[model samples]
Target chain A: MNPKDTSTGTLSYEQAGVNYDLIDPLKVAAQRAAAATGANLAAHGFTEVPASRGESAYVVDVGPFYLASIVECLGTKTLVADDMQKLTGKSYYDSIAQDTIAMAVNDLITVGATPLVVQAYWSAGGSDWFGDAQRSQALVAGWKRACDTCGVAWGGGETPALAGIVEAGRIDLAASCTGLVNPKERLSVGDKLAAGDAIVLLASSGIHANGLSLARKLVERLPQGYLTKLPDGTTYGEALLAPTVLYSPVTEALYKAGITPHYCANITGHGWRKLLRHPATLTYRIDKVPPVTPVLRFMQEHAKQDDREAYSTLNMGAGFALFVRAQDAQRTVEVAQAAGVAALVAGRVEAGPKQLLIEPLGIRFGDDDLQLR
Target chain B: MNPKDTSTGTLSYEQAGVNYDLIDPLKVAAQRAAAATGANLAAHGFTEVPASRGESAYVVDVGPFYLASIVECLGTKTLVADDMQKLTGKSYYDSIAQDTIAMAVNDLITVGATPLVVQAYWSAGGSDWFGDAQRSQALVAGWKRACDTCGVAWGGGETPALAGIVEAGRIDLAASCTGLVNPKERLSVGDKLAAGDAIVLLASSGIHANGLSLARKLVERLPQGYLTKLPDGTTYGEALLAPTVLYSPVTEALYKAGITPHYCANITGHGWRKLLRHPATLTYRIDKVPPVTPVLRFMQEHAKQDDREAYSTLNMGAGFALFVRAQDAQRTVEVAQAAGVAALVAGRVEAGPKQLLIEPLGIRFGDDDLQLR
Candidate 1:
């Protein structure tokens, strides 16, 4: 019934009000336009690392080392917490803080840069949004806990009370980070992505900070709102607001074990399709798809979304991906396990057109869908 | 005659809905909590610069070099642009972009760090907001122009369409930058702010990304809306939207001339009260207060504000303040002028309690007004 008319003839992300077709092109144009200003760095005695313009973070060559920085927002996930807070007397901002930091440090670590500092930007629609003492204390505790989890300092942040720019009762949360990729050789920008490379996927802690807008849209149709019980006996809102898995530990473990990833992708925004984010003429064929968590399945069934649409829009199971040499695949999974994260060799690269083929679902996404270039 | 009466019986910034009493303590508490997590950075071989926790930027001591990073928002200035767009068919996002970048890079340069790269976070309430191609193009062009003006690379940015969390049809613009302070001696954290240190005031174009909530409230009482002409013959909105002066050039000039400043303050949200943001117990005495710009005077007069509240809330005239030794004050102004920015010897630091004294206006702001610590 959706306008996109997928193979299932049911629903699509485009119909869910997220028109990636319009947004991706704008991002591409913005990147191209912004790249022209790279020459300005020369005046400050720093040069932008070549080909780092379109990555999750921008890396700049600062003489002896490279600094990677990124500014990311937590999206509408906090709205879910706010909704649940009204239904249940508990505050979920503690978990939301972890989700916020996870979104930033995950992208920061994807380039092998160890995050040094993380800054918070909490914009409340009204000053009264912080009147709840429990919520405020929980947010502070959780932000500090998340920073401790990732081995990054909790850098100071700006809390602006933006009365009219943001929604009256809700808060808009965002953060930016600076990480260091020293020795320069550790910088990963997908130059090593090639045929025969093995793709290893790290497990996600349920829906990790992506597709919340579409998920929130689906929540509106729920018969019981935030009180809806899921198959696992927990409330749906509680399950969806679970703290995200921090990936910097896995990355640090990999570095400790001397396993250098050729390419790394933070499984956010674009879902599992982020595995093929590298710019290379190779087919990424997934032989084994990870099991979907209960929260994801509940939202998928209720939203009337099929495998193709859901997998392409949310992190079905995979939270992060690493493409490394074929021999390093098993060891990479071992390092992830040592760091308390579950991971496995899920796919391989083949000499062919740029595509992502899912064997279990019989879904194939072409390069046209990934217009990051 | 009006609400929230002080002894002077005049309008106050607190009446305009921004209560620093609540917001300042929360910030102080958040900083205190975030500092406990700084020990996490030590594991990554990076240490937090002592006492840098509460500064404008969080500085990291990375062995041979020090890095300063900051995340600042453009405040409610964009709301003015949105309102102006409806009143007139023209978009003012271009100037808004400069204001956003100025908010970021200005903070970066305050620590004597040369801004190396700037990353933008432009989150719109809906995807359809970009349907207006002219407005989107203007924003991108303006962003790049501002980055160019600051002599920093326009590193990649995240343009997330955050529906429901942000106000519909509006965008929340903020940016983060990482700057390097090489030689380490270039770092300035008020340690060099002696009692006899002279203050060099840099002229502001108008209100630069602060006090827009009060300014907008004033606009409502206007007889002619955006077309309301001020004494300078320019409309109130037009003058307020003037591009912010990029202070990176001045900082760069100072760096080139080897005239390290004792302290620097970006006169933003807290206005001239920010001049005494340093922790030292010294009075910042302004014997030669700068002339009030036309746009600011209009906001004060029409809003029925006294000189004390006006100078304490808006920039009035001074955009930035640099405290240096009395001998280097003239050369600092000369260097600022060489960079094409207007500067003047506005004040001096005196041995007294922590306060800001506008002697010319017969007003004094105690340490209670500036409470980031």
Candidate 2:
């Protein structure tokens, strides 16, 4: 029996506070809208003009062995954070700055690159001219300070005073970052992956901004203290808002150490199953899933969510995962630990068609039929 | 006489069918919520990361003369496009793409860099198991085509299936770009502007996607053909959706011609008045504004807007303006013409506290109240 399936009530998109049904019509309309823009072409042809679609960032070769990537974040998180009143205690600017960094650097590392520069765009809600200025400066300064500490260059940004859409006190923050990747070190999903490789997990700080819809629903159902102060005295907000760990140092260390993992993936919104986009049948034998952090435990208990649902919806604890040679697993953990991350030899890979099986739990998830697929 | 100032009946954000006031409160709530996230940083030696209040994009240096800029368009346009049932026309995508390009390249050029690559993020309303594949492919292809035609590399992109906030038919498109600049050729507002530099104007295609809040209202009050179609028999959608003119060629021409303009500014959302960001008092004498394109004439007639309001909000005909030496005025126009852009001498510089004077009309606008400083 699934220990955590609490309520048998039907849970749908509307129940989760989102109307999923409207999406198809919206998409169809969007395609038609996109087609009408055929006349808007640039001189070099429309071939290289970045169409307004896809991932928040993309990579390009600027020179030999040097690549540039751009990354951005959706403003929806800002809306959620605002509704929760997370700014007064934590400095909303700081959370967004970290989010900006997380959004950018995560992608950089995913593509085997190191972040080098950061820029941000902040759209303030108010019409109080000076208030906007102060907030804009404060936000930029915080981002600059963070980037400076990370040894990344702080490129200038745009502060748009969008009075009509943004409210007096609200501000929407998005960031784009450029990073460099050595052409030879870039990794794609199709890169060869053989069975018997070890799968390593780097513990995550918690939610890290993706899957907020479900997380929000779970939080809404819980008693107040469940998110703010657990029985253990830890505030739920702090645990959930932990800035995504920057894996630059670790990835850079691995690169320098001449340890090239067969695959490295950021375990974000959709969790472990989404990472298996490669053409290999592999089963992961997990004798140890990281101990449930306090926040995760609270969410599971209060929301009555099943283990599979929790794992599928949240990062749980692992923010990044690595597929490496079984022989090199020990060294990989050592290297990651040296970089200050608590790395765990989470699982082992076995021969199979491209599949993800969680042992001990006996839960199997695959790319085919996945929620997002 | 302001013939286009048709009484749209005190139209406001809410009355325009968008609840800007309600959205404003939501914005404040969201900002406050985001602020609460900064207190969780325990290991990075940082207590709080400031909120990105107004900055929209961030740039970080990955290598010499190479920088990455990341940005996103708030889903405002997406919602509007979806409501209009013109999805495949891609007005939203194309507009956002142009705006993204404009925002990035304009900034890059401000710092004397050339944009070389662009990456985009597209979130379809949902994961249409079968339809998503084809739609995503087409979207990517369109984005790639745009980037390629602009002489920039179409790197990689992400198409996330976000089924919640975005309805089935609506998609949000955002992008980031990488640009290259010679350390020596960088330009800023402080670069130098004498009293005699002539201002050259390059034509704008249409509204080019900014100030839509007002434009849409005006369109609604007018007849069906008022905004999207003109007396010339061209569809207004096609005209309004005209792709932004890439200024790269013009910039390159000016550079190669050895005629460094006092300033080369893209006439976008804020128009002429916002261009006077420098400290010096400079007066602009406008003997000729580019011929009012059919779209502008239609907007003027239908909306019954004043010249100042129209010029300040829309690009009119000129998309880019250059402040060049009086002697090089003719050459600047010739070069722009050679690059397939119709350029003409629109105005000239004069001694005064840095001010933009639309002569003949005798209207002067400045950044006195708008300046962030």
Q: TM-score: which candidate is best?
A: 1
Tens digit per residue, CA lDDT, model 2, A73-112: 5434554454445434334545556766776677666656
> Per-candidate TM vs. native?
0.96, 0.74
Candidate 2 residues B215-325, lDDT tens each?
Answer: 556655655632355678876545555556667667767767887766666565555555564456667778887788786666655655577766766678877777888
Residues B1-373, candidate 1, lDDT per residue (tens digit)? 1433432334567767786656766676688878888898778777888768667888899988898999988889988888888888899988998889999898888888888888888888888777778788888889888888788887887787777778888888899988888879999976777899999999999988888877777775777977899887998888879978899889888978979998899888778888978888998888897788899988888877888888878999999999998999999999999999889999899999998889888998998976657
DockQ per model, Cα: 0.74, 0.16
Give the clashing residue pairs of candidate 1, or none: none
Q: Report fnat, model 2.
A: 0.10
Poorest 10 consecutive residues by lDDT, candidate 2 chain A: A44-53
Best by DockQ: 1
For every candidate, how close is chain A to the native chain A in TM-score? Answer: 0.95, 0.79
Alpha-carbon shift of residue A279 in model 1 (angstroms)? 0.6
